[model samples]
Target: MEQQKLEKLLSKMTLDEKIGQLMQFAGHFYATNNNKDPVTGPDDLQVSSKSINYSGSVLGSAGAERNKEIQERYLAQSRMKIPLLFMADVINGFRTIFPIPLGLGASWDPMLVERAQTISAKEASSAGIHVTFAPMVDLVRDPRWGRVMESPGEDSFLNQEFAKASVRGFQGENLQADGERVAACVKHFVGYGAVEGGRDYNKVDLSERELRENYLPAFQAALEAGCELVMTAFNTIDSIPASGNQKLMREILRKEFDFDGVLISDYGAVEELIPHGVAADQKEAARKAMYAGVDIEMMSLCYENSLKELIGEGKVSVDLLDEAVLRILNLKNKLGLFENPYRGASIQKQNKYLFCPEHKEVAQEAAEKSCVLLKNNDVLPLRGGKIALIGPYADNPDILGEWSIFGKKEEAVTLKAGIAKHTSDYTYALGCPMYDRQETALTEAVNVARESTHIILALGEGSDRSGEGRSRSSITLPENQLELLRELKQIGKPITVVLFNGRPLDLMEVAELADGILEAWHPGSVGGTAIANLLFGKANPSGKLTMSFPRTTGQIPVYYNAYNTGRPLPEGSTERFYSRYIDTPNEPLYPFGFGLSYADFQYESLQLSANELKPGGSIDVQVLVKNQSDYSGEEIVQLYIRDLVGEVVRPVKELKAFQKVFIPANESKLVSFSITEEMLRYHHANLEFKSDPGEFKVLVGSSSTDLLSQSFYLK
Candidate 1:
């Protein structure tokens, strides 16, 4: 397990064995140790038996006895006894499902987010997982990108904090010290979130400045927090595929960032280089990936088939292949896999940790904090009324979002179950089909609505509608579900729309009809309980939106903190020549960091330590947040900075710092933030990350749209 031992093991590996270590395949490649023969083999890929035994890692594996069986089967067949590494897409949670990462971003409490991930690590490790592809820190400007749910949100600074938190939570203080921890792998290396037209695996074209200024920082933060691995994106960066882009994978990631950790290609990406027109054949693709510094090829045979030939010939060196093989072995050694191949993997651990009551409590609390209350009109906190819970998700329990591969959907609590906990004076109806109009279902729902004093319309995209390869051109509620709202609005009862979705939706129609709208974004296993608690007065909603909700699909990439154009449209402008939209407003329906709590928070008497700030000096900005309503709640006090003049054009406003404060009913809390010159620094035209001495404005507010402003000068 030590370095000397790892090197000795690496030195003994044959050419075929060393190449096998760099090739990754799905979980089906490994046969179980059970008495029955192996059901799936490497036949389709035409991989040999020796390579199957020596292959370094496995993907999409269900942990517990199944993993132990595979490890036992593999070790028995291995020549050097090198254990197989088990990695999974354990993203947010493994079995005890938490909110999607977007929902975690809405919480804005990284420590709380960290707690949830810690629970995820505990659960996942018990299932025999060694690594997780998580904390996807890509900056998303386009909500139409389905995988946007996997990212934290649009801001780089906030996502950086989440990135660090994810690394800390998953890797912990020492990954090898305890079997409970799994190494964190921050993925889609660079600019995968900004795909053309918000489509998955499409072209990712960005200027060097745009790439450095926005997308690269979060990955830097993740690595700085000691993320153990980097996964390449499927898309191309600078017209070169990220899996085979030498400048990005080799120079920037290796030399500049100095990430000595393992670099693995995304699923089947190394083979796709041929289709990308970057390579002529699989052999050429393997050569390019090795030259580009890819350590491992996931779900592909390009490396398995071509690497041996390339190394034998003069085209590629054995040294390049050795460096990658050693890295993979080093990871296995660090994970204690060399010491114990079935580390933390047992039926006993699974029974004790998976879906435990304590873990489920954290999942419930997280779901409660993650559900954002986007709009309210004094119709919330449903103070005792005959409630009509109508829609597709009423009794259905598939509220767990995508990437919840290990969670049992049947174990999830239904919305009806949560409502029963509050009161039985509620009628439940499946109002309409999820994607189509059902007139009979609609009439039943309307009739129930007529008898109820309040109508709760739970509607949004299906769980399958917004994960990997699930991009949507239209980002809004279907007319079938919207029809339920239209028919119920005629009854004119106080309507509260509960949305179950992954991405920020175009709520132009629902915003007009619903009196209250709560974004319960695929609120995981305890989603129903979380929603019901907020519906009644049991809990207060405190989640804020991290991504902007577009007014229409046309504003696909709409977000706060965008740079203004040369010819900017003035507020409330009717001018045609200025940069503005013809049919919709430039602003989103709901801006970032926007949420409402049952308790009203008022910002007053913003004060600054000094009117001028100098280099290496700090200024303390303070504001008093008072809760006016009787309900005690948590409020996110946001601090945004605007550079009035810069060497280059800056954003209208940039979020520098924020604090989540809890105020008792009718009490006040003084929220303070210290701003230093380093926080004001930006990447110049030449990519110099330093601050410029200029006038600046400090805006303190609850959300991006509503703010109280003050000014200062950096001298």
Candidate 2:
């Protein structure tokens, strides 16, 4: 659609019709009779029939036939014959699922993450979805937040990289929205991940510097990558509900970030403004949301029923309505919906592409690269010995983590199934029930363990335990599962534990008992295949911890790169006055970037090109990485830099750059990084982003705790 045509079309819509453009209804709103006519009406809805008939968009995933029928009926009855935009939550994949976003973060390869989203776009677009609410891109440090499963991890720079990759993968090059791709929607605007107490939809209160320095960068990166849409958060930002926060949305997001895309409310957040105390009712909610720069009201009738009245009474500007409608129209046009409303949506395409082998291969590889080997005492690479596979997840294929909406658990292969392909000598039994100990089941598992030469135990939270409203006060393995492990430990056989969950968990007991541990964080779809291969030495665990694994649940929000406190605990000191926990250690159980590989890697001396970094010039930093083991493996070399003196107190060390390299057995590789003035920028107390002239430290390491360091000057 041309600019002139879109403007002219907008000029002709009535008040009711124009307001309808900003109103989105879920798919159930337009139930149709077999006669291809909508049998449902706006009787229950507060909006008039005209508004319901002219609703601009529908939310939900449906077959091509159903979407086509809905669009046909909608157009036939529309006064302007406008096409209805369809959107769905296709975060990981529509059907051919990959690992959850956090697991994708652990992969730490943005290009591979990009490929996964591209495949997600392909399958989702085939199902008549024009937009996907995905690539969460929120920076989460707390594992208690269920949607941490949706974030890349705690680091801002890594999240930024994944955010760009996710946006690019969904929209593709040139930002052309075609049948093969769905427009990407970067979500929850700002600071949804920093919700207090790690509770869902909790209030977010942060200083301007904290918000900008740590939280705002990733959203900026997504916008820079040309994300087409932004979703408002369900919680309050600076005490104002995000959908109704004018300073945050209109000033920060719309102006500061310069995002000119459509801004939609997350689910029913628009109406929830009343509960947030910012709106008196739905009408006030609509008024505040519109003024605050929300273009589309999702799953709510506020915009449908009250906008016309507000505009008529001069309480709200009709111009804002026009602006919102135009943005929606522009997005629909960008998606090429005007040219072919039913593009990329066909049962034929769905049958040919969904759950196809090529996509599953990608899923398998993603799973392989995403599983972190946390501990291995030479018990991995299981030999030709009889195996006992026991646990709730041993034969269960519900490994598809939460928010994998379109994926089917029955279609996924289980760890038992994957191991069976290698050998039938493995005996399997129940390692207790999922949440409790069944005496009979535990006895059976112990008997099987005694009969076998080794044990491959699978355990973790159920899929429902860590998504949306599923927050846990105690982030530990279920007591029964731990009891089962304690029982199996008496067998005195080497045990390898495969952890299947979404967020980082307290693994102290499991770590102590298991000879080896594979942190398989809900490797999706063909995750079983990846797990099986790694157990038998067919594949190597290359993934690292994007989020820190706490030693105990008390360290709920633990992360690397924290600020160096004034009374920082002395290294190896148990001083009482220092900032130390009385009971637990200060460090995480496994710090960020921590992982073990079958192949051993050694880091050589750190090298720097210069002692001082001058303005507009860059200093080259390098480290030699050597593989000592016989197996060839991929290594993610991470670079961290710390500002010794800043206008504001800086983090102890922040991840500035990283590279994923594959080295052959007994071979060495040089991992290099270039540090410019821009890389040294930080948010001061006044919120200015610039570097300070001072001493700095550069560190290269496999993880945050294990590092080789050197000092430099920036002038």
Clashing residue pairs for model 1: none
Clashes of each: 0, 0
* Model 2 C-alpha lDDT per residue in residues 463-571, reported as the tens digit of each score: 8998888877788999999999999999999999999998999999999999999988888999889999999989988999898999998877788989888899998
Count of backbone collisions in candidate 1: 0
TM-score of each: 0.98, 0.98
In order, the Cα lDDT scores of the candidates are: 0.90, 0.88
lDDT of 1: 0.90
Runs with alpha carbons beyond 4 Å of true place in candidate 2: 32-50, 175-177
Per-residue lDDT tens digits of candidate 1, residues 390-496? Answer: 99878788788888999989989877899899999999989998899988999999999999999988898888999899888999888888888999999989999
Kindly report which residue pairs in candidate 2 clash with one another.
none
